[model samples]
Target: MSQEFESIWDAIEPTVGDALVMKVRFKIMSAIIRECRLWKVSRNIASKRLNIGVLRYDQLLACDIASFNIDELVVLSLKAGLDVRLEVQGA
Candidate 1:
């Protein structure tokens, strides 16, 4: 493999992963919002449940969730009364 190709892959891989994570996080946030409405819990309260600050929660709600890892999202989902499930398909 050429060095240029490897460099491109290195750049693209993380971008692709971040895009995927952002999409998943957006979906998770949608679900969390639904649960919050049903439970009549405010974002501030939800942030506390997730052990994060209200400001951070606001940023997350504003779609700045790329900074959070999958594990953090899983924990947030659980805190929002969601059950996280993982599925893997073999190549």
Candidate 2:
């Protein structure tokens, strides 16, 4: 028999809460990456704009999710000129 998951995080995370956190982090990271692409800026300039070091920005570009927490991603998103919003849905 096989089991199916709605998301990759759901299958990988140990619990629902952990999966939710990863999902949120991925979304924020995605938005930041998108903004970076749209800005068409070099890594050094982009990192400066986002107020992060070049290496940290490289980690983000590489989608190194384990290196970042929700709060840090949120702050970085803001510095990238993204308008962050939260919506809570009942499960």
Clashes of each: 0, 0
- Tens-place lDDT digits, model 1, residues 1-91: 6445334334555686655665666677777656666766787777787789988877767756556666777777888779877677898
Candidate 2 lDDT over residue span 55-91, tens digit each: 9999999999999999999999999889999987898
lDDT against the true structure, per candidate, is 0.69, 0.95
Q: Give candidate 1's root-mean-square deviation (CA, Å).
A: 6.4
TM-score of 1: 0.61
Top-lDDT structure, candidate number: 2
Worst 10 residues of 2 by lDDT: 80-89
57: Cα error in model 1, Å: 1.4
TM-score against truth, every candidate: 0.61, 0.95
| lDDT for model 1 | 0.69
